[model samples]
Target: MNKPLLELKNISIKYDDKLVVKDISITIQEGEILGIVGESGSGKSTLIKSIIGLLGEGGHIVDGKIIYEGKDITNLNKKELMVIRGQSIGMIFQDCQSSFCPIRTIGNQLYDSMKAHMKVTKKEALERGEEILRELNIKDPKKFLNSYPFELSGGMNQRAGIMMAMASNPKIILADEPTSALDVTVQAKVINELMNLRKKFGTTIIIVSHNMGVISLMSDNALVMKDGECVEYNLTKKIFNSPSRQYTKELINAMPKLKKEII
Candidate 1:
């Protein structure tokens, strides 16, 4: 069997000396989708952020190791982490529109990002960006690339965000509530696009969401978190059908029947 692509061994995170995530652990294989699901302040977001070293101000990993491809990266410096971020691990934020700069054309921003981790020129980056946009089934990839973030609708911007994260062809994509801000139709589109990405590139994905329905639909395995601790971790079908914890069952019960049935 192939070794796990990423591993979180007893990870504990803190902000300003206050522990928010405690003893959370997960193992992800290549081309697999792992969903981290929990309610607000459940530390789901914080736990995901720690993997890519994005836990902002006063937040730090107090214990445990983050092993990627069998290497310990728990204490890498900024420069070291920077080299790994986009080139090896990509991230898609919840508010993708806000993540983009209003002044920069989408193409310009994409070029800059690609340039940072690659030796590609502006023209090359734009070409690659357009190719990915086309693959995502975006209409008129060239027009969308030239358009600014504000010029696009929320759903379009979210797609652009996915495009940007995927530009590097990283092994893993860490998406934090990537579809929560969109309507149901748009959410389905984004979710389907993400699934397609994995199928096409064999990219491993770690998606964090509060929506149990989303988790059930996208993930191969589920890690259910509550108050910074993992209450349950198992195959998605097993968790949905036979959750071992009350919290996991409650989350499933809260989902609409339609959504549950769809899962």
Candidate 2:
């Protein structure tokens, strides 16, 4: 059997000396999508952030190890983690627009990021960026690439963020509620784009979302979290169809289903 692409072994996290994420563990195989779902403050985002060393101020891992491709990265320094982030594990935030600098053109920021991991000219980077944007079904990719982040709509920005994350051609993508901020129509589009991304690049994704519908649509495996603990983890179909935990059942029941009426 092959080893997991990424593994979290009994990981726990804290913020300002207060425990926020309890002991949790998960393994992600290459080219697979793993979804983490829970209500707000369930530490879903915190757990994801811990993987790439983005726990922010006062938040630190207190226990266990994070192994990626068989390497222990739990205590890697900022300099060491910088090499892993983006180049090895990309991230898509809820509001991707905020990731870009307001003053820079989207092309400029993308070129800089690309240059960080690989030696690529401005023209080459722009061309590659355009290619990814086009793959995401963004119309007139060149125009969007040349424009500033503020000029694009929220949906466009989110798509561009996904492109930026993919620019490095990372082995894994950690999407932290990538669609939560968008409307239903846009959310569906983003979800489809993500699936398309996986199909095209064979990239491994670990998505954190509170929406069970999104989880059901995107994940091969699902992990149900609550109050910073894993309530249930299983195949997506099994989790939805035969949830063992009451909390998991409630989450599934909460999803909005279309009703048919007979006259």
Candidate 3:
């Protein structure tokens, strides 16, 4: 964990004439968990999107570089990017279910994904996927794997998404508001599973969320953002206990009473 796995140096993103993320720089070290927190529209999601080159249309990284594994990926061709995403870096979105095909069963997608990235037959992929889901505490992996996306509850689908993200054993995982849709109990379970991934695979993780409480439990370092710029970036304890910015202090104050441990 001594070396930086990914570095965002003075990165700026814009959609048409409107600037979203401005001069944002952060370093994620090996086997470290980083939390990016901010209110809605604070450029949290946009920042991550810029990382994986998934900014869709009209969004561009106008300045700065994104260094990954000592290589600058700030601007790469389509083939170069395909070689990095999924194989080396994995991403789990806020609405996990939305990423799945409504017409496909869980196993179908899992098998195809595995076959694409690994040297495995469909049968082998299905079995491996079932085992991964079971390890994640998904109930009756066989049955759930056979079910369509809508057949399972939101929490189950979210967990399945997490399972899929880790199935490839990527070195880095980027979670964008992974637990926002789940209840408190389910949220804890998801966070626990993510921590387990770090311990088991030494996966470097970057979690983005609006909840400071979630950040407290999941990240060692916190990055507080507002209006597309970093308000504070430091160790979690410092951000919580002695925030340098008034906005960060207000964020700690706004956290629920039950989550006093965050501050």
RMSD values, in order shown: 1.2, 2.8, 1.8
TM for every model, in the order presented, reads 0.97, 0.96, 0.94
Candidate 1 vs candidate 3, TM-score winner: 1
- TM-score, model 3 to reference: 0.94
| Local lDDT at 182 for model 2 | 88
The TM-score obtained by model 1 is: 0.97
Q: Write the per-residue lDDT of candidate 3 for residues 175-211, one digit (tens) a residue.
A: 9999889877778778888888898789999999888
What is the alpha-carbon lDDT of model 1 when measured against the actual structure?
Answer: 0.91
The lDDT ranking, best first, is 1, 2, 3
**Which candidate, 2 or 3, would have the higher TM-score against the true structure?**
2
RMSD of 1: 1.2
Positional deviation of residue 56's Cα in model 2 after best superposition, in angstroms: 1.6
- Candidate 3 has its poorest 10 consecutive residues by lDDT at 254-263
lDDT of each: 0.91, 0.89, 0.87
lDDT of 3: 0.87
Off by over 4 Å in 2: 258-263
